[model samples]
Target: MSENVRAKAQETLALVDEVNAMVLSDPKAADAVTPLSQADANLGEEIRSRMDEIDMTDTQSIISFGSGAQTELQEISQAMLADVRNKDVGPAGDSLRSIVSTIRGFSVSELDVRRDRSWWEKLLGRAAPFAKFTAQYEKVQLQIDRVTEDLQKHEYTLLKDIKSLDLLYEKTLDFYDELALYIAAGTEKIKGLDEADIPAKEAEIAAAAEQDQVMKAQELRDLRAARDDLERRVHDLKLTRQVTMQSLPSIRLVQENDKSLVTKINSTLVNTVPLWETQLAQAVTIQRSAEAASAVREANDLTNELLTSNAKNLRDSNKVIRQEMERGVFDIEAVKQANADLIGTINESLQIADEGKAKRAKAEEELQKMEKDLRDTLASAKSRRDGVGDTSGTSVPKA
Candidate 1:
């Protein structure tokens, strides 16, 4: 394969390896979950591990596809390079044309001078053999050209396949990243649920009960109950207001003004006991109304606090989700890039294959040259030095 193709393939493989490493994300690796509780942290770790596993699986698949495409491309590039080199195409044509031109030019220039030479010499002087060889090479060159052209076309198709593989790699990487972020976010949410805010609310409820104002309101309940009972009892008595007013001191003074009638009037007062019952009922009604108003006010104040606290909790949780999204920490894009990079790395093997060819060829060439030189040296050395085996020959008796 050409060097460029080999280099690209190598780059792809390296990238794939890098992507795989990222995807592998060491099973033992751990990272912190910020602002998370212990439970959330544990959950996050587990999720991260799972994400890594998924990433590995996904990256492996992407690598496989990419590698396959790369392999094909490398093969194509190699075939093209091989065809270009091995096929006696353009270079052969150039060499043959040069020979034919040289022969024709020489024949034209030496035509008169060749008349004196023998027929055989003149025949040989025209370079007929060179012309024949050039014709033969030109014929073979056509086949080489056809092969090289086909190989070039195949290389073009390989480039398209590589591009497709690259695109696939990028998409997979994006998906991987998205999945990771989503899982991370979900884990966090689960952690939130596990670390439920209800406990705090329960604590608040407990604390609310202990507040002095709340306790005071609770104390007033018994007083209100007592007042209600008293009102009920007073209503059953059915005392008249007019008779109740007669029990007052001002009314009693008028009755006492008749001193001669005072003993009978005083005796009449015993029948006026229902009038005092009426006055007691009025007093109870006024006091109960005041107490009820105070209780209602206290209840409303406490209820408002409960509503406010509950609203705050909902708002806070919503804010957490929003903040997390805004932070971009759980972004899917990173995963996608990683996946794509991994896919590209997979294709690198193809590049490696392409690269290995040139090195192999060069090494083979060097080996052949060394062998030829060694043969020549051996032939020279044998003439000078006797074919002496090593000075010391080990001969061990059978044990």
Candidate 2:
């Protein structure tokens, strides 16, 4: 199957398993009586005998087992009916009717005999051996049916558990893989601090300043700018380190919690499913025995106990998973918050630098304008002086 489909199936299975566990754990179903204990031993023996005749591996053969047992019960009832008809069976008919009623009570399906009848019909119903025997036979038939249903339900649950376990295991592996990558990335980013070379740059700038060599004014300005840039880079790196340090604890804590959750899931996957299978098999065997009411009660009690225990385990496991998930969410938010703060700081610093650049540009523009005005004024004065000298010369020549 494709990964997505398989994952969806696993998720569905887990959800179903959890819901079933919750339903089974509820105390309300504890009182529902199981009739296997009150069932007749003859009924069980007859059912088993019919089962032996069929090839259980074959669907038709298994189905025949039920039909064959029902037929046999019918024949027994018919013979008793013939006896009742031929001669007066006295209290025997009443006794048979009581047995049939009891069996009817045990039936999962509502038999026709279960409906309300007139007072006369109710009185006559006891006198009919056929009716009583029919009810009794159907009751036994239904027992096998109940057993079959229970078996199927248990088998389906086991399959779902297996699927859920497989999915959890795969997820655990994936989680660790992703966690490793996360850690690696974090480590790499922290190592970026080393690449900043703050100390080396500081030493280089100091050595240049100490040298007696005459440097141009532009060169001096460039060196000072480089120093300022390096200082800003160092400050930013320090902030990054602080954020990383703060987040590391949460990251490690979350990872540890996740690991613990995975371990618990693994433990359940390994142990719980097989345990359920074993218990279900035992319950099925008890159901087939058709012993006294006590046996049925015992079987039900055991089933309930198994269900309750598994449900509790699953609840505990689910709790851990939930806590881990919550912790993960908290950690993510924490990291986001830290990054946001760092981003805000960087934005503020950039804004300040941008303001400084704008101010410097404005000052440079004003200086250039002042220089142009001075040049214009000097030219205008020189032009006026030359005009005066020309005028004086012309006046002297006319005189």
Candidate 3:
């Protein structure tokens, strides 16, 4: 080697030694960045940790680099909405039916509840009717308690989801750091190859050619090929680093979606839920205002009122049953939604198909464009070696 090349080789070795010393001497730096070889080993281990190591209950989550994170988040949003829906105490639409059911629970008919002197006195004077009503009110109060407890549980669950997002955010930060270390190491490795290894090989190849040392030149070419293979690995590492870059934003998007869901749940817990509870209380107050009339209505016309109510209920029930039975299994609105979803899925599929078709066409065009160049190169090679043999004692067999 020339003095300059020798000096350059020494400098490269010194630089590599300096890097090793830096990593080994500094504990913080050592922890932060693993060497390229060790990083590859770590990556192999990471890939090896598959389903058995993963949480079985993590089915609700999207894996780190997989698809459908947005879709999974959307489903989570829908589930959050569903969790808090129709959470009031009782069925608010059926007041008359509620009152009738309360009255029937006592099993005292119109005649029994009426006031002559003996039966009414034994049944607690005029308060006999209020007994079942008050009992029903107590039952409703218990129902409200149950509903409130359920709401609190859901709130707790949502808060847990928020904490889960925090955990995910922390994990993402770790991933970012890991990816940075990997990219830095890989870039350093590639830089070393480009600056030192390939240049040294090229210099040796040139000196060999000058001396007409064909075997040495051939051996140098093999060394260059080895470097090229390392370059390919570095290229793959860079692509992996790119994927890690993509993972950062994708993880953040997932975190942001989780935050949004938690925000909505918090809003329901902090604002909407209180308002709903107030509305429920006001509704109970209004229902209480109707209880006095409900308590006293059975003197003699109680039987007539009951009969009319029963007949009306029967008629309403029959009409509802007939209308529902005559109706198709699928509602028009449901059918419309299904049609919309189907169209959207088909359109998405077609879009993907078009993209694939375009890619295939482009690939074919490039292949055709290269075909002539490839043929020309082969023809040139054949002409150069037509009657000539390898002067290095390497034989080329007849094709």
10 residues in a row with least lDDT, candidate 1: 24-33
What C-alpha lDDT values do all the predictions have?
Answer: 0.42, 0.44, 0.50
Residue runs of model 2 more than 4 Å from their true location after superposition: 1-215, 291-399
Candidate 2 per-residue lDDT, tens place, 1-399, comes to: 124433444444454445334311111121221232343575444333432443323434422322322244345436545643654223322333443454445432222323456688677765333344345545554453343333333334434433433333333333333232222222232233235533444445567654532443444454445444433433443343344344434434433443343333333333433343354344434434533455678899999999999999999999999988877545878899999999999999999999999999999999999998878867665665667576653442211
TM-score of each candidate structure, all chains considered together: 0.21, 0.22, 0.34
Cα lDDT, model 3, residue 348 = 100
- At residue 144, candidate 1 shows an lDDT of 33
Q: Evaluate model 3: give its TM-score.
A: 0.34
Model 3, 86-135: lDDT tens per residue?
Answer: 34433322432443343344322322323344575567755554454455
Candidate 1 root-mean-square deviation in Å = 65.2
lDDT of 1: 0.42
Quickly count the clashes in candidate 2.
2
By lDDT, the candidates rank as 3, 2, 1
Which window of 10 residues has the lowest lDDT sum in candidate 3? Answer: 22-31
RMSD of each: 65.2, 60.9, 61.7
User: For all candidates, what are the clash counts?
Assistant: 10, 2, 0
